[model samples]
Target: MKFFPINKEEMNKLGWKECDFIFVTGDAYVDHPSFGHAVITRLLESLGFKVGVIPQPNWRTIDDFTKLGKPRVAFLVSSGNIDSMVNHYTVNKKRRNTDVYSPGGKAGLRPDRADIVYCNKIREAYKDVPIILGGIEASLRRFAHYDYWDDKVRNSILVDSNANLLVFGMGEKQIIEIANLIAFGKNILDLKDIRGTCYITKDIEGLKDYIEMPSFEEVKSDKLQYNLAFKIQYQEQDAIKGKTLVQKHGNLYIVQNPPAFPLSQEELDFVYSLPYIRTYHPIYKKDGGIPALKEVEFSITSHRGCYGGCSFCAIHFHQGRVIQNRSKKSIIDEAVKLTTLPNFKGYIHDVGGPTANFRNPSCKMQIEHGVCKNRQCMHPTPCPNLEVNHDEYLDILQEIRKLPRVKKVFIRSGIRYDYLIYDKNTKFFEELVKHHISGQLKVAPEHVNDEVLFCMGKPSKKVYERFEKKYHELNKKLNLKQYLVPYLMSSHPGSDLSAAVELAEYIRDLGYNPEQVQDFYPTPGSLSTTIYYTGVNPITGKKVYVPKDPEEKKMQRALLQYRDPKNYELVYKALVKSGRTDLIGYSKKCLIAPKKIRR
Candidate 1:
């Protein structure tokens, strides 16, 4: 079949009595590698299993979920590619007006806490079916976590969703192991020991070596205990040396086994070569055809996982720290395929993953031993053991650029400036400016204050300055007028009025008025969110100031775009509060004009 069956009639056309597995997702069915549901379902189909998909089913009733009937093996559930709450709401806790993952970019197609909602609906339809939860929502929320919407700590998603198994991380290996075990007549309760999975167990007597964290009740009531639990959970995410983790939720225990080993190069290549139609299902063509597919239809995921360890990013908690990249042949073959598509417009939107420049492990030692428990690879400073090379990646990009019918290839994903600067090789940088730039290069220098950068697990402001200066120099040498768009954030942990003012000054110095800015969103499973909730950094155990007041947050956000006329009053108030009123006067170096001078 060109596409997986979404209903029983399509299933029968394939001459199947019942599917081996049915995936329930909170997104419109787009059979692309970028979507988690597509990757998992396609892999299962490649393994000779009859897999089907039901996308964005109505959680308000069991009718939509029951249309697919029961699966012979299991029901795989996910909140699509991201956490449902993050997708449904904005940083200000307001309901988002549109969902790019839905048909026609419509909101309200899926309910909030989609993983739990979908699982509950499934249980109502089939009382005894095994439901395996995977994807970002299930992976990141598998442990007891602070929910921003709820404004309180909640039990592990496994506990709330009532799924028999929870597969975390990139689930290619874990899901296959699970399918084999279940197909071989093993019960869900008997499959607790599989790496990269979580299950509930009432007994821990047989589990010999595992780390126990604070219970759900303890984390809910005590902030210190919450931070401690997060620290323990974050440190043991490595696949090689990580141990089992157990967290108590009332009478039951949530047991997460060590992460599954990363896929070998050949294995990674095979997963991407699946026979995917690479667009939304035909059923969605009537409703404007799933807006999310447009962004990634022409793009390629060169690799998976990130070692940068930015505190606000959940990639570390979900994709893990180790880099599992595909072979150059696989990436190039995918690019060649894109050129043949009917919609191929000769432009490849992106040619990277979580971090564009990271194509290999941060260090060789991480392969034998796990990533360092207490330290990051490229934060505060790049580790001495770090291996900085971009030769293979550059070669792959060069080859893709020369492919037939492919006009331009851009690197839209993030590039870690600190890691790039450490390379000491100018070839990649020179080539990037000469070839890959798409008029404007977007990078993230969230804030300019060293204190804020430290809290964010990012490099110092000086590193960004060095990178900014060099980027312009390369562009100048190449005689290209490409602009550098630095992404800025406001009101993050450890950011006070003074820090906000300092960032405004940096913006002024750059002579760049940002058109877009981001507010630090306290999403679940991020170290920044933990710090926002607990008022302490889990890694350092030091108290950090958090801006909780709505007014102060508004002022901080206003400071980012202080040039806007609408933000004048907020910026004026912020400058006054920070004791930097000199920046409000009509001096040549001032950020704003004085109140009397405006008339």
Candidate 2:
């Protein structure tokens, strides 16, 4: 019910002379469970460990890192909930104007590559202290990942940050086990076997238990080897039957254990029930609070993990593909608790996780046999084993809507429409249209071209079309005018100028100008990014075209919003460049007129 210690004064109030762990972060302190730092620190505290936080420390100097003194256990480092480079720059690599994670939405509060910077600063403050890295930045970059900003493959972050250990995925289970080992007077090197943790060793001796990946030298120099290496590592991410993986970086070995098991409903409920203040620390009250907290303060994360394996997303590599949910009673408990907050205004902004429509594993078979490593649950075609149902999700929403002060409950975390359409029960779809949608229902069909969709690990555009039709029918039956807003992307790895034109035409047929267009950003650890860098699919090893030219990338993005008067020039150029000068005349079918507009 209270915030954790952030400074020496708060530590004094708690009567703590020294801490067990000092958590260093790249974000302003927001004591909400949604924030990685709060969840990890709270779970540690729940287990009777003293933890302190140094949020957005002055990494330029060692003074701020030593403020908490030395921790008896280890120093936990995270680059907030998002990667630092993605946080600081946009798709065009332009410096972003604001950072929601920082107080007052200010930019430049945290340095670039925050995990490495913060860990290095901690090392300067106290040499030989164990540093454990987690959070999105470290988790996805835990392997030899392609850094889009650097335009090359970099070694595992363990090598760069020099951290003693790295914990990927949701760290509740791993952190507990790690703390237990440390409490027993075990050395950091002795704690390598814990699931979800990665460690470095000078020699690969005694690592025969792990599945060895292609050596760093081979993967770095040969694109085919890199592709094969990623596919093997991707398959072993399953918590159940996965073998530990080992990869060589020069003479050193980076060994990663299988991911920790997903939290059971009872266990997940306990973590959410921890003492979360549900907002930014009051110390940031004067600077207008952290912008990130404003988005989720009223919202509830009812679950974790995602089944929708969009190639551009890092969720599977981090949260895994297995779905984990909080118990119904537990979710209702959180919803009721939300009504007590001072800012409550009759709305529960959202109630979902990675994929809102997903509440359970795709099928019962997933429990006995781990999710298919080679096949997706619902991409290309829905696997026969894929059981598409949404009754449990609908029930939870109906219960939350009945809460006294809760007037409306919206699902902004996004629903997998393809899966909804695959379900035989139209009841969930009907209820979603009638109750859940807030004027517009947002769904990501990413692109219209099936080739691009295949490369992105998304379902074909036809699936989205079917879902769109069903959505319209349901809204009509309910006498509502709800809209299905499709989230579209341009310049994805497989998309060339011709593919971009198809998407623009699809948007034209839909008769709506997208308020925003997502230019495919090749972030690290994404399947799409792998192809963008290597021009080969790690899974299929098929060559794919990538949009790397800046001008070509600009033209693809411009075509998505060709209807926008400002995009006229780029649209015209894209049409001409693609050898589609036929679309550049003053005809009804033409995207733009040959004559230049004032814009």
Candidate 3:
């Protein structure tokens, strides 16, 4: 099989030979480590399968697929990121409030349909070729999920995409198995024995013996229960074992694999150990205008998973609540290699992860005793089980910064403000600013309302505000312009008009107009969506206001970006309508109001 670069020259040099299979994916941001699609492609090549990568495929038409010709086996589909839902809004109201997934012009379409549309187009062009969907988007959406766009729950993507198989979770082992099985002439339907993959189905009659499907109520009410049900249905061979569930949907058998093995520390280390051949933008191939490639400055992750179980987050659910890290030495080696690249400019040196500050397992001592709980150690509140020390990570960052080519090491990932404050490791914060920041630090205070914040399992907004003030004060004292860029989310389940108005007022009081505002997107498989659907806190069993009305949610989102006259008018009216006129024209409220109207 022959390989083709997205560029023409590389395609010509590869001799224009046809490949056995083509891998199409939405993740083309090559430098990212998490997607690891590039590595997977390389691995597939090493195994003697001729494969071509269609990174960020043109979802608009079938022409791209026709050019590649049909493969003997199947095409692999992934969103690059763990899931597509995370990047998009499922509700129409939420979609309007934020520009998460704008339709791509000819090249870009809706993200959800981008893959499905592209895949179907390929099928239309080549009817006999097998198509397979995998990655986070397919995996999580393989079952019915709460669609924020529709403001209601929807069925699996497997049903919508019409792909042969849906691979879920970390798909390294499963992908290899799929390639081998298809190579050996096994039909897609016959490969159901293989674990960690989900397939479409219509009938759940006989398969009930092997898999137990949870009621919609159970799944909607408890995230852990939903996860546990999923775990039982999709168990793999080596790690946790799960059985496939066959549910009926109009004469088809929808097969879903359980969550696969949580990558062991050794496995996690090995993945990071692979050489990162950071490639320049494919468009930069012909032009001499391409930025530095040799001294390429790219972000590398230090760890994955988050133990801080913020109710609105999905990192803990999808990646697991446990903190997984790359060895400090391994991280440093990557950093050193990055420094050697000629294109490396002195910019941001991001040491990112789900939660970068969380380097090692939260509870090191408990591991020795084999006493570990899968849930967040600091649930309900901070727990003693939390391994709060970041000294090791701090040392690693320091060493990375000391590398010859490195100028600045910034932590672009969201900092756990609560964790830092709780750790009382103020010195680390000081060092973080002195060394890592590149003019700004990003922190997520999601919402300012205490009730809303409490529902999010976050510390008080006052706490974060205090941290922000202190950070600014420190920067001022040091004569540095560095400042905190707080991330705020609007229209979360518990956020009322008053709560959102409060947050807008707070933003105004801060004397800053944020460059961006995040409208809460209720992705499939997240705890937040569960709350959004059920209108009750999954953990607390407390009643919560999850506004289903599109207009109300839109107004709530507008409050965050209150500079728009329409938004300000809507929020102001909402405040007055709610009988909270006390907040109307408050100094903070006026911050987001139009300049002429502010009084």
Candidate 4:
């Protein structure tokens, strides 16, 4: 298949008088499945709709909104694959220097809140066109939640965008239903009963069998109420067991239907098979194609859904946890197609999803009863029913590596080491060290403190250590030298200066100084973000400490990379405030030097 129309000239070339739908996006259009906009639009076109793409449209005026003219059906808006705030700014709230989604890695091509800004511009241009908001920004902010950038609880994006409808989750199934209903001459508001969608209505009449969450004002006023509201929403995420949710924002009630069901293997294969040029729009050819596509152009997605629900991740909320894998035949076909690409260097970048090595549901029970509301699959401890196997995944990798013209197959997506350790079979582990690791393997051991790990819903440090030991052992047995690169985070909800110090000592003992450290980012829809906002763990209902003070946050961050010369002052202050002055000395274990006097 080829790219759909982008302008009137292209539309005329296709013998179309007007586009059936116009897709407005914050990202420069790369017609690949990794981009939600591309997947949604391409799927719609395959279903016999005339689709037009408006990527990174000018929000300052109505010109870009009218570039493709009004669609015959509706205007679809997305803030790209990520939340706009995350795209435009760093965790420290500093403006990012480059936007990989933009041509030539340009920044500031899209507004700070691209969904709201672009929708407002569209509303101004056409007062009656149906405006639909989707993608990560809309899906995560579909409810009344906290905004870290603003440091306050904010209303849902649906209320602020003034859009007629909103589609949450992966949106393939949701958007198709939306388009079908719209074509049937139903008003957008009347199509509210569809799953994986949210809409606003003043009248809550006949809205029975649904859970009513705390009002917007109540969550803003009472932190406890916010905690309760978040817990309820999280519990009701499963498609089979979830109930409809409702929240009040003044006179209007925002209604969220149950999540869409996981697509079947056949359905998923069909979606991935739709013609994708698999690159950025040709309009950006001279500006050097989108940098975002470089990493994924040759990669193959083996599955969807992740049972390893990390508290900091939105996977459960956005993609659900019921694992769905593509058939091996489908996967191999894609790998063969990758070899035919002009840029193929006989390398397959990745063969995994949210978490590599997950090929099925955590267990058979979850597939029938939906994921547990209060329990996790592999955290605290692996559940009794959890199925720990990687045979299918390893086999897929081996087959791809044997493909003609395929030089190497690398599992770039991170592996869940805890799961690997649980598997009784050692073949997967041995093969991983011998084949998968280019030089080092990446794992997220967010922190060493048990208390903090408890709040983050991560396994104990001992688990990571056990896996680390086994990794090197297998590598040694195989006569190969490889290392582990542990990804660490700072300033999580339960992390105080004490916890940061403990992490620093662990780093020192490992004889590793990480160049990059991630600060706890409180994006919407994350359990960890809820903890950061309410200062309470919704699960345990216990009060947790949050490092909100910017100076102290800087100190905690410095402790993670205490060896950096520039972070010495911050590290010293952190150690002093925590009353751990013993950590400051000329000893080799010391994180920083003694005070230096400049005369």
The estimated TM-scores of all candidates read: 0.99, 0.98, 0.80, 0.98
| lDDT by residue (tens digit), candidate 2, 276-365 | 888888888899999998899999998998878898998989999998899899999999999999999999999999899899988887
- Stretches of candidate 1 above 4 Å error? 597-599
Give me the overall lDDT of model 4.
0.91
lDDT of each: 0.92, 0.89, 0.65, 0.91
Worst 10-residue lDDT window, candidate 1: 590-599
Residue 5 miss distance in model 3 (angstroms)? 4.9
Candidate 4, residues 255-349, lDDT tens digits: the string is 99999999999989988888888988889999998999998898889999998878899888998899988999899999999999998988888
Better of 3 and 4 by lDDT: 4
lDDT at 432, model 1: 88
Ranked by lDDT, the better of candidates 1 and 4 is: 1
lDDT of 3 by residue, 1-599 (tens): 22335533554577655666677766543532444566566556657877666666565677766666677778876775535444444445323233211212122323654556666777788877788777666666766666665655455677777788877666766777889989889888766656667776555455543654564455556555555444343222112333456544445556765545556667666666655456634443554321322222477778777777787776543565556677877888888766776667855457868787887766765334322333346654577657567688889888887888677888876688778877766777778878887777888888889888887778887687678777887787777897677888888888888788788778778766776887777776666777777776655566789866777777777777767665777766666665666665536444433336356
**Arranged by TM-score, best first:** 1, 4, 2, 3
Q: How much lDDT does candidate 3 score?
A: 0.65
